[model samples]
Target: MTLDLPLIWAGLIAFAVLAYVVLDGFDLGVGILFPLIRGEPHRDEAMNSVAPVWDGNETWLVLGGGGLLAVFPLAYAIIMSALYVPIIVMLLALVFRGVAFEFRWKTQRGKFLWDWSFAAGSTLAAFAQGVALGALVQGIPVANRAYAGGWWDWLTPFSILTGFALVIGYALLGATWLIWKTEGHVQRRAYDIAFWVAPATLLLIGVVSLWTPFLSGPYMARWFAWPQVLLVAVVPLAVLGAGFLLIRGLTERREIAPFLASLLLFVLCFIGLGISFFPHLVPNSVTIWEAAAPDNSLSFLLVGGVVLIPIILAYTAYAYWVFRGKVNAAGGYH
Candidate 1:
């Protein structure tokens, strides 16, 4: 069988990216919501809910970045150059958040400092990520396989709006997660936040969805053109359905349903994005076939990719299984 190696690698990279967003997203959500929860015990319980898996959740980011660099060096180079500032900011924030996660419990006097650090770091990282996504959809200026835009190219009005939308979305996810992983007052507070945040998240999604089609020529065609139109049209309906399920689940107070529903909502959004830019790695700039590395190099990397991806999947599943259940202040990382 002739392998469409580039397409395979593209799919792998996309999967890794989606996995990172959905996985790390909720934990980051937890950190973002930390400031509003009131008191150490509640915040500690929230931290405990994600402590075991947050670091592991970020592994997909490495996988996504490494896969891009290895599989599509041209695209990677152009994208990294275009997104350098936000990417750097995001990484630094992640580092601060990780350190805060580890050190918060060690000192009684500085716990509040660490807590603020964690919240600030998570907020910045999430905003940076959304900005990067906005920049991608806003379209990078690529010429001669190099980034052709200035440092501020990524900071458009659309990008800023997307960043705020992501914060609300992540907060909603974090609230649903708390509902899934905690009991008593913490869970109740999560429910309250989620009830309001859910509608707000959907509203932002609607604004972004409506605004997106007009921003790029390809997206305009991808979302509105004939056959492509019909096939792509289901995304919004699916998002609506997912949102409905999430809202209903929350109202019913079913622990896992709301979280799963939120996940479904994200997955549908990811799918819609993947569909909108099927073969294009940089939207109007580059295609997978155009950006892919040499076949021999991809073949060599494929060997490791085939072996490693499944192992990562297995371990990720195992970790969630091991850590599944209610979390409390006393149960947190110490």
Candidate 2:
């Protein structure tokens, strides 16, 4: 039997992207909540909550991007051409956020500025990522194997809504994370913020989920068609279950359940998106096979990926295992 290299690579790339979102998302969420955190000590707790794992969480991002470039050069080219502005902005924001992450600990006088920088960077990066995702889901304008859209095509109202939605979602993630990883003032404040942000995130998720189907006929058909409906029906029920648990966790003062619930909500959303975007890498334009690299090249890459991926997973698991437990209020991992 001929192995479906394209399909395999597509799934691998999808997994990488999802890993990035679920892993790096909380740290970015911590940054997004910076303004609401109050006091340098609270912020320190927040930062320390993610200090050991934040940089490592970004490896999936690198893997996802590089995999796309190597495995789907055509799609990468078109997407980059379409989303150059947002992509650039996201990269620059991430750079600023990383600098602030380290330099904040170094300087006493400029610490406040670094704090703002971190917040701005995280917020902007999250917004830009959402916008880029929205634009992609809305479909890139492609002609003769190239992007044919205007520079500002990514700045639509729908995209803006996704941007705001992502910001809210990330804030919720950060708050829930604080709930899991900190105590005293930071934890209480996080619980308070999470109680509000959770509903807002769900509201935006509903808005975006509703708006998505109408963007393309295929999306609507895939969601509403008979057998597909039976299959897709599970997503909404799962989302509702996750939401219920999230609210219950926050209300009952459960520490870790809310964070797990929030992550489950994101996983469901990602799965829903996968349902919408499968087969077509460019959504209505290019198929996975069409955009994929040659089988020989894919085969070579897969060998390396198999070895590298497990190692990555191993180290990531080890890091979290070592750092498990509430972040220390007085001192953090150096």
Candidate 3:
């Protein structure tokens, strides 16, 4: 089969996005789960669980956006234009979360403020990302490859639903991370949260699945088709199985297995979405080839990717390896 540069670029972009969601999603979830509990020791355990790897997790976002700008300039421009406000909000949220992550440890009197800041920032960032995704999936108001809609066009009920879905999704990740990293009371709390959040997230996925077809006729057609339908059906079953296994593993005190299962569920869900939306970077508005940059530009990006992606992978691996093993209450950030 002949290689399609646009399809290759699309796959690369999808990889970057999925990496971001998997890596950063748990850290963001940790932030969201922070305020729900009380006491410093528990909080420290939560922070340390993500401390070694959170920064590295964000690298995927940079790579994803950079890849889009480099190899799919048209799609980048149109998406940025349509999602200007939400993107700005997402950036600010990230900034706030990053700053608060460091400063909260140093300051005592205003620590609560920073904690809330961290949670709020994470929540906003995750929600904005989901909203942007939902808006894309729902289709931007585009004419002649340009966005043609009011600023508020991105803030539909569908976007709102997606936003909350992401919040729950991230919360599930956070809960699982806690299960992996903490012991005793904290682990119990995390498991409890997961028990509740998992079903909610599953429901949200169902809702999105049901709504997506009505929202986009082409998406419905793509999903309901023969072999594709089989693959799509497999994703939900895998997700449900993973979720069920997670609950069982946690209840059985299987330690690390539940976290891994939860991560697998998230990955499966993301893959399902990617499958549903392949070849269309901007839903119905723009095909990947139309949105992609010239072959020469993509070739340049491919060269950069050869070098950069490995370095990213190596550093990420090193970070996780260095930070391996369970965190304890005595083990706080330095």
lDDT of each: 0.91, 0.94, 0.85
Q: Write the per-residue lDDT of candidate 2 for residues 90-158, one digit (tens) a residue.
A: 999999999999999999999999999999999999999999999999999899999999999999999
Global Cα lDDT for candidate 3? 0.85
- Higher-lDDT candidate of 1 and 2: 2
Kindly list the per-residue Cα lDDT of model 1 for residues 234-292, writing each as its tens digit. Answer: 88998999999998998898888988988888898788777667689998879999999
Question: Which residue pairs collide in model 3, if any?
Answer: none
Model 1 segments more than 4 A misplaced: 332-334
- In candidate 3, where is summed lDDT lowest over 10 consecutive residues? 325-334
Span of ten consecutive residues with least summed lDDT in model 1: 325-334
Candidate 2 clash pair list: none
Score every model by TM-score. 0.98, 0.98, 0.95
lDDT value, residue 44 of candidate 3: 75
Q: Between prediction 1 and prediction 3, which has the larger lDDT?
A: 1
Report lDDT (Cα) of residue 230, candidate 3.
80
Off by more than 4 A, model 2: none
On residues 123-182, what C-alpha lDDT tens digit does candidate 3 reach at each position?
999999889888877888778778888788889999999989998999988988888878
Query: How far is 214's C-alpha from truth in model 3 (Å)?
Result: 1.1
* lDDT score for candidate 1 against the true structure: 0.91
- What local lDDT does model 2 show for residue 146? 96
